[model samples]
Target: MTNLALLGARLLIGALLIGGAVQKALSPGDAGGMLVGLGLPFALVWPALIYDALAGLALWLGVAVRPVALSAAAYCALTSFFHLNVFQATGDAWQMTIFVKNWAIAGGCLALMVAGSGAWALRADRP
Candidate 1:
């Protein structure tokens, strides 16, 4: 397959997680507190960062696309479910927008899992 397709797919999904990872990594105190306030454990933040960072990097580099993308898809779905009670959230409602968006991203990740990484990738096939 053409590398452009892979590049587009990777960048589209990878950038989201990469940006999230960076944001969380940089200001985890606030994020962790927010998670705790949301009834989610604060202790999960660090491991999430690591997972997002690794999966983001893997997708960005087109390495182990299937496995990482599969995990990322699950992550996206769980995060969506985690935020399911946003109607009761004390935080801004805007944070709720990503519920559907994450599902869409998960769909894209599933597509990548089936398609594998295209050309110009570090490891184009599933690991």
Candidate 2:
């Protein structure tokens, strides 16, 4: 049961990242605009898309699970800041919800890091 749960978690997170990359790839102009709005370089969108795809693939394949999970956790936590705009109220309540969701995802990644890949993984790098 635990291994199954871990696999499910991995699948969910991996799919999320992969889907996000696909979305960004489909509409790079939109992604670039968002990055610029967040005070980031528009050129970053390309690298971010690649990183997300690669990281998602690594997690899905259960490769170096602990280290990948740790990196994913950090990625989630840092990216959540992009959604946060506490000072000036933009009247977009869903932004806050997304920010919280990112943190939750980060927490999940932390759990995955501690638990390793579990028994059902492709590589099963058990902690």
Candidate 3:
């Protein structure tokens, strides 16, 4: 049951990341603009798309989960900052929701990192 739960968590997180990458890819202009608006280099979007897809895939396959989860957690926490200013008087409520959601996802990633992929994985990191 524990292993199943872990697998489910991995699948959910992985799918979310992959889907996010796809969404960003679909509107790279918007993504780049958002980054630029936040004073970040537009080029950052390219690497973000690649990293999200690869890291999500790794998580889905249960490969190097601890390291990947750690990175994903960090990624989520860091990216959440980009949405931090979405609570202004005229800011979109959805953006704020996404911001909080990122932190929640980060917490889940941290838990997965410590749990070490449970008992089911392509190559189990532990017995």
Candidate 4:
């Protein structure tokens, strides 16, 4: 049961990252605009989009899962830091909720970084 839960968590995280990357890659212009609105540099946005896509693919393939997990954890850390100020200023419950959610997701990413994807990985058969 524990193994199943871990596998489920891994798949869910992998799927979310892949889907997010696809969204950003397919609509980079829009993603870039959002990044700009977030006050990040335009140059950073394109590179970040590429990193997200590649990392997502890596995670999905279970090729170098640890590295991919670390990358995802770092990305989530940056996101959490960026939103820390928003978390402080929010009077609305929804905003506060999302801020907490981001932190929780960051925690989950960190856990994946430490726990790894285990034996059911796509790269398991590789020598």
Residues 15-60, candidate 3: write the lDDT tens digits: 9999879988998887787788877899999999999999899989
User: lDDT per residue, candidate 2, 42-116, as tens digits?
Assistant: 999888899889889988988888898899899888877777753134657777887899999999999999998
Number of clashes found in candidate 1: 0
Q: Which pairs clash (backbone N, Cα, C closer than 3 Å) in model 2?
A: none
Clashing residue pairs, backbone N/CA/C < 3 A, model 1: none
Local accuracy of candidate 1 as per-residue lDDT tens digits, 1-127: 4578977898779888888889888899866876787788998899888888888889889888888889989999988855655535656576577677889889999998887888768877843
Error of 1 at 73 (Å): 0.6
RMSD of model 2 against the true structure? 1.7
List runs of model 4 lying over 4 Å from the truth: 84-96, 124-127
Candidate 3: clashing pairs of residues: none
Q: Which is better, 2 or 3, measured by TM-score?
A: 3
Clashing pairs in 4: none
Model 4 lDDT at residue 113: 69
How are the candidates ranked when ordered by lDDT, highest leading? 3, 2, 1, 4
TM-score per model over all chains: 0.87, 0.91, 0.93, 0.72
lDDT per model vs. reference:
0.82, 0.85, 0.88, 0.66
